[model samples]
Target chain A: MTTGVRRRMGVEERRQQLIGVALELFSRRSPDEVSIDEIASAAGISRPLVYHYFPGKLSLYEAALKRASDDLAARFVEPREGPLGARLLRVMGRFFDFVDEHGPGFSALMRGGPAVGSSTTNALIDAVRQAAYVQILSHLDVQDPPARLELVIRSWISLAESTALIWLDGRRIPRAELEKQLVHDFAALAAVSAAYDEEMGALLRRILKDEPADGPFADLVGRIVALAS
Target chain B: MTTGVRRRMGVEERRQQLIGVALELFSRRSPDEVSIDEIASAAGISRPLVYHYFPGKLSLYEAALKRASDDLAARFVEPREGPLGARLLRVMGRFFDFVDEHGPGFSALMRGGPAVGSSTTNALIDAVRQAAYVQILSHLDVQDPPARLELVIRSWISLAESTALIWLDGRRIPRAELEKQLVHDFAALAAVSAAYDEEMGALLRRILKDEPADGPFADLVGRIVALAS
Candidate 1:
């Protein structure tokens, strides 16, 4: 291919190239340790070309984080018909697998950068967290006590985040054991929230069984419960 | 005082000066962002003189983190008294106060450096976390089913950490409103734990009313039920 033609391939391809290499470098060192020059060199491109794709290091970091978040969100949104508990386990298992595979990038995104103000990193973390929150809230059928539902959703995310961090720290716990503990912990926490009283649990079961098939709220709630059981 | 006499301060005073200035810098920037020179200069001492007090930057960071953690622990560990709910609220209040006063330093220590691998930052974080964990566990009076008690303690800390982050992230809710919501949320969560069942709640009430100095666990149980109910 001609050099000009190769250079003009497409924005999407170049974006992916930058993101892939950036993830690799970020995973190896802290964000502050990785420079634009290093990313461009690692990607087999010039520094100017890297800038042509991403305005700056912060933008590139955000884009890389978004890419990872998108991948994670996709796993949860994928079509799956099963009991809520089973569905949640499948989703969490996928999450843990992703962490095992890309521990550094995930850790960097979650821990965030202290030197960098909480602008981009906070937005990304919030987006990912909201995705999980929406997944859990969509499952419940109760109409009263909105704050209670919010608390449950928040607690669920807290449990998952803490467990993921603990595992990622590599404290010598076997992956299998860690996953098992997380599943148990999640299920127990969910069971309590789902059944504040027997009435609530029954209502939740009904809602899950016969969720309406239309409207934005319906879709949102359906997705949440589908992953939360 | 003569210049020589002024330069020869007691060891405790010098150590305190180093920790105080280190915390100030850490609050404004990441531990990695603040250099030894900056810390020393900010404290009105030469870099070499600063090194005479602490081995290096990492040691200075660790010392600051340790002091903050120790102060927090001291505030949280109360003498045994009152209902479990009351006691828990008091302890939770202390935690909230600490965050309000030392958020920057705490954030620096928790989110500053690589979470894992060989680093003094990680060691300091681990030490603080373990100390907090022990303080929490010591407050619990789990006489049976140790596993359930473990779950309760983990869940409590999870709630506290999540709430603290949310508050720090600048939620629109008023501080009083947020604290109220947190107390309610934590109480409900603690109530659901195995130790706070209906039978135990009744027993705790009896112990609080009649027992003289009902020990740490008894005080904790009574306080948890009081706040939750």
Candidate 2:
């Protein structure tokens, strides 16, 4: 019934909107540099209005951190059907998209910089990493994977994150090329992991079946085989 | 020179002493949190004395960064007389020492946190990485390496950097295991690169001569051979 300058909004919508504004501001600067007044003005609302939604700046920041981490976790999810290579390419493509869209925010969220205030935000970021790890494991057809496979995958995830940060910070390579390279790196890491663990070795063989025999992955596999021989 | 409370310290010594104090402070807290007063008091000097050696906190911070890079570069230059694996283990051991000793300083320097101020500090950090790249290249016994070899080493270096940050940020694994794992990862990365580049492949074969059959490296090579078959 009310749709005017003083339009009514639900509590969740208002809270989410405030978080969106904070996230936008935070994406550009560290949390310390962002004042309550700046966040309010950026949101096109009064300062008190911002405080009304969130008691303090740190609370607002935590909300933004949640929003970003949730978005990143959602991006890692892709359909498990198709060649693993194709699926990985598509999933990595989405990851880069998030980086492109959330430039500074991406940096802030990933760095969780020295400016980070509390352990709550740190835990929130850790949850994001864990969630990504779980999603990566979901691709494998195992409920209880061996410890080494889990470690390798987790290490690969860290590699992916650092590589993305460098690519964004330096614009080192084209996004398409970077995506393919990361996928190749992941495959290579798995193959390398296979070098020491029977279970991981089997896992690589299982995954390789879902990949075609003639791309960067095939080239990598060919070289690995040549080295072995 | 007068030997009293106002004894004259050489320009270089005074500057270095100030940096020493700043580095200690920075190792414990992020740059934003460390005030000039704390830096001054920590060094047993006055605030003006700090300003005398450096223009501001940022300059002091930059100097500390330069010190870290120099010390780290020095660490990586182990005697080239030993077997490459032993040498790398030694070099990586120093790296881990830096990671352990520097702690938050290492995190701040590598993360280049969202609160990062000027590009000068960044350029200094980049120079450190470039120096590392050169040092790593030196160990390869190649004056002019192929692009792929360079990429693999560089990527490995990034992996090393991120792993250090994560290890410090969270005691994910014990330092000894993490060091061995990283060294293995570098060797594995090189092997993966070898799969794509014959020269790198040859390099791997050459290096394997120094490794014993009972070690992790041998196990990895065996698995790689198994994959090839």
lDDT of each: 0.60, 0.74
Kindly report the interface RMSD of candidate 1, rounded to 1 decimal: 11.3
- Name the docking class for model 1: incorrect
TM-score of 2: 0.67
Estimate the TM-score for candidate 1.
0.57
DockQ of every candidate: 0.12, 0.23
Q: Quote each prediction's TM-score.
A: 0.57, 0.67
How do the residues A68-111 of candidate 1 rate in per-residue lDDT, one tens digit apiece? 77877776663445455455666777878777766866666555
Cα-lDDT of candidate 2: 0.74
